[model samples]
Structure formats: structure tokens, C-alpha cells
Target: MTYSGDVTSGGAPAVRELDRLTITKVSVGPMDNNAYLLRCRDTGEQVLIDAANEAPRLVELVGDGGLAAVVTTHRHMDHWVALEEVVVKTGARPLVHADDADGLPIDAETLTDGDTVAVGGCSLEVIHLKGHTPGSIALLYRDPAGTPHLFTGDSLFPGGVGNTDQDPERFGQLIDDVEHKLFDRLPDETWFYPGHGKDSTLGAERPSVPQWRARGW
Candidate 1:
């Protein structure tokens, strides 16, 4: 949600622990993009999503442990720059889509649509949301309470959508995927965690559909 706390004295963004997942908002490079750490509650397995540019901070947060996987939403430098350090420290498998899987600096498991990866008691459903990047993906997982959670990298934001300057067709496809695959199929109560900004429920952002369609689709 709101980034309430200030950055730590060490130039690292604040870290928030959510149940099993420990989300560290690493302030890296000039952009200060957000990086996430997802750890399993039961097995203590950790997964880092989008390290952005904060390699050192990401390493610090993921001290020696079961670093299960490194899942990147896309191949942007901001998202994967720190991935090399993460791979060395965690020894976790790197996950990404087949289209944009290259120069990862680490070995990765290329994933396709409908593929599932288990993190603790939950399973992450990989959904292709192409817009920000050709192989951009959103990871879906249901919490123990049965609440569906979507980790939409840079595809879908709270009140807005990701930038689509590169390819209009890909961007249009992303909008279509969200409309038909996500909003139209999933329940309105699904919780969304984007690549930046506050978290929101599907119902809260559903109204933005018309806006997306009018502008690009």
C-alpha cells in the first residue's frame, strides 16, 4: 500500500514482512524501483521478485537460507540488474517467460502460460500479460485464507496501466489479457500487487478498463 516508512540509513528501502513473504522496497539506481522478496511461511523458502537495481540490499535481505526462486516480471535492466547477486546468494532457480529469457546472468526456468510453481502451501499461476515487455508475466497465488493474489509486474497498476511505448500491439494484447483472462475470469475480490505504488483489489481497478481500451486497445 502506502510506503509509510523512510529508507534505512544504509540507503536501502524499508522492508515489510507479510506473513511468509518479506517485501523489501529497495531504493536502487536513479529510479528507486521496488524489489520484492517472497519467502515461504512453512519451509522458509524465499523467492525474490524484481530486484531492480539494488543488488547489495537484495543480498542483505536474503541472507543465507533456502532462496527458492528468483521470478522476474520482465527482462528490464531495472528488474534484473541485481539478479546475479541474488542467484549467487540464494541458489534459487530463476523464472521467466520463454520470449524474454536471456542474459539473465543466472540459470533460469523459462515458463509459459498456465504453468504453475509451488511456493510453500500455495501455487503460483503464471499468466502472460504482454505490454511493458514482450514476455511480461503476472504470478497468481491464493493465500491460506483463499484470497487470490496477483503479482502483476509492470503490466497492470492500481489506477493506471504500464507504459506501452515500445509496441502498441503488445500493449493492446496486455489489455485484452487483463480484461478477458483476469478481470472477466477471476473474482472481483482478487488482490493486486503491482510493480510500483499501493496495492488494490480487482474491484477497485476494474473501472479503469474503459480507459485502457479507449487509449490503446
Candidate 2:
């Protein structure tokens, strides 16, 4: 599905409202990493994904409601360059999978597969997918009146799965998790937001699973 929204000033990115959730996608840092702000319309409770960079802009997005949590998809420097600043400014706790919690800039709460994070009345289910990193994860939100939305940190993307280790075993694991845990289960209309670049849907990417597997990357 196409998302049309107003872009913010100073490279703040555009805001897309899906049902009760308002998502703002911003590209930041030298790597051009994507940071997303998810807000619950009814309660104004918000959750940030990545906190990749540009602390000032992120703080501006956080505003007065502050953030309920900042979820780090994996233990990657590019994804958390502004984590400390954003967390400090918003007083929002940082969360990461237990396997990747250590070595983060600050203390973080642990999230396991199937764990649900509540943002006001919205619920985001966590799905841990191994490969790109031992603890990479994706969050799924099913809108009551609309299609389900998925926030895949660095796991699944539009063109293909996230880059993985050269090792065949690691690549296999990632593909397995994605195919079984994601593609096989979720509906075709599910909207997937990746860690970087444009968004896509399961319907759009489903046909390429075989191609992705054969390519082995």
C-alpha cells in the first residue's frame, strides 16, 4: 500500500498515520539509518525504533508525550548512535533482546519472542529472528480495523532479507526464521517497515522467497 504524508522540516521525515498509530520514518546518521516513531492516537503514547541518529530531531519528534520505550532491533552501532541522547531526553527505557542486550550504550530491558509491548492501547508482538545478528527482531502490530503492520528492524526488507554472515548456516537460519516465522504465518496485506529504505508488504515480497533462497543472501 502507498503511504502519503507530510514531511517534517530539518530532515525529520514524513509522518504516516495508519488507523490509530502514527508512524514517522526518518533517515539519520552517516549510514542513513531509518528511525521510526510509533504513536498511539488515542493516548499519545509513543515508541521509538532504532534511535539511529540526529538526537535533536528525535527529541523534537518525541515532544511532550515522551516515549514509552526505545527498542533496539539488534546490537548494531549504526542503529543506536543516538540512543543515549534520545533516551536521556525522553526518559524512555531502552529495550533489546536478551541475546544482544549486553554492550549497549545504556541499561536495557530484555524482550523475548512473543513478548507484547503495550503502547497505550496498541499491542506490538515481538518476533526474534536470528541471522543478521543473534538477536535481531521484528515487531508486529495488528490494527483493529485495518491491515497488520510489521516493524522489522534489520531482519526483513522489501527486496530481500537483511544481509547475513557469509556462512551458509547463518544464512539458512535467517531465511528459515523469515519464511516460517514471518512469510508463512502473516497475511499478504501485512505492511512491513524495515530498518532502512521504503516500506513493502508481504504480498509484494512473497513471490520472491524462492529467488532469495536460491541466491543464498
Candidate 3:
């Protein structure tokens, strides 16, 4: 599916298409993290990308059953602080990779790469990126409009890329995943919504891959 939109200051206004599914971004927290609410216009099925620090807005969006579940890109507090509230409000489970699943403020359904989640007539495929954290996974799916979307938590950014200085082996592993797994496998034009910063397409980010790799981050 082709998803197109006019570029804007906060990335592009989420593209609305004939398909019932729409992604509304709720910019939350001190760093202005992007929390996405994936909704099915027709069925009212929704999935929350990150709870971040905005419980009020997040809770308001969870009123519809379209908010099927919460999918966290990583275990960071900023990304998950409101998870419990959203879960309580929507009665939806929180999905996360098994590795970073521990010490979560709330218990969640442990997930791994390749798991498929269906909500509001949309199904998302899970991809294990494993760079930002051992269990870091990216969600991949094509909206009804046929636009390919990747919800990359803190893994890949517009120009800066994910921080790997936390752990040497982990950081090195993340670098490898970006070069071989994410950049190579996914379509170059795939739209990427990272944990922070403006959104960018895989094709748009390809030119910087070399620079990212050269940094040995």
C-alpha cells in the first residue's frame, strides 16, 4: 500500500486513507515522545503504541474497543509509565518482548518476534530488532491503505539513531541489526515512527546508514 502525506514539523500529519485504520500521534512527556493510537475507523478497534507520560489523553483514547492492546517498543519508563492506566481503562493487555518484560510497572503478555496482533481488522507482524535492548522489537504492518509502517521505539531515529553506549555488546549488536536486519530487509520506502524525533522513511534514511555504521555506535 502507498501511504503519502505532506511533510510537517511534527513529521507528517498521520495519513488518513480509505482503510478504516488511522494512527493519531499524541506527543507526550518531557522529551516530547510520540505515542501512537492505532485505530480502526470502521470497527473501533485500537492499539496504543506507547503510554509515555500522558495518562489523561491516553485514557481518553482508550474509551473505544479499537484500543485493543498496548504494545511497548522498549522497557523505558517514559514509554510505559501510563501502561497500567491504559490497561485498566481499556481492559487490553500490554505486549512486550520477554527480555525487557521484567520490572515492568504492570504485568504484561510477553511477546517475541514473529507474533501477530490483530485489532480492528488490522494485523501487525512483530520483528525482533534487538539493538536498543536485548528484547527490543519493532512492530510492522501495512495499513488498509497499504502503507507499510514500523513502530521503532528507541532503536532508530531520523538522523541520530539509537543510543548504544549503555552496553558495548548490546550496542554493537544493535548496529548490526540496523545495517543487516532493519535497513536491508524492510522496504526502503517504509514509513518509520521512532521513539523520538520526526518520522522518516526507510528510503530517506538509507543515505545515513553508512554514516551511522561508520560511527561504530
Q: Could you say which candidate leads in TM-score?
A: 2
> Candidates sorted by TM-score, descending order?
2, 3, 1
Query: TM-score for model 2?
Result: 0.94
Off by over 4 Å in 3: 1-15
Residue pair clashes in candidate 2: none
Please write out the lDDT profile of model 2 over residues 108-158, one tens digit for every residue. 999999999888889999999999999999999999989998999888988
* C-alpha-based local distance difference test score of model 2: 0.88
Q: For residues 15-111, could you state the per-residue lDDT of candidate 3 as single tens digits? A: 4443666776656767678787787677877888888866767787565453678998888887888889878877888998999899579888988
Worst 10 residues of 3 by lDDT: 4-13
* lDDT at position 48, candidate 1: 73
Q: Per-residue lDDT for 74 in model 1?
A: 88
Which should have the higher lDDT, number 1 or number 2? Answer: 2
List lDDT for all candidates, in order: 0.75, 0.88, 0.76
The estimated TM-scores of all candidates read 0.85, 0.94, 0.88
Lowest summed lDDT over 10 consecutive residues: which window, candidate 1? 1-10
lDDT of 1 by residue, 141-202 (tens): 76655567788888888776788884678777878888887899788888777776656789
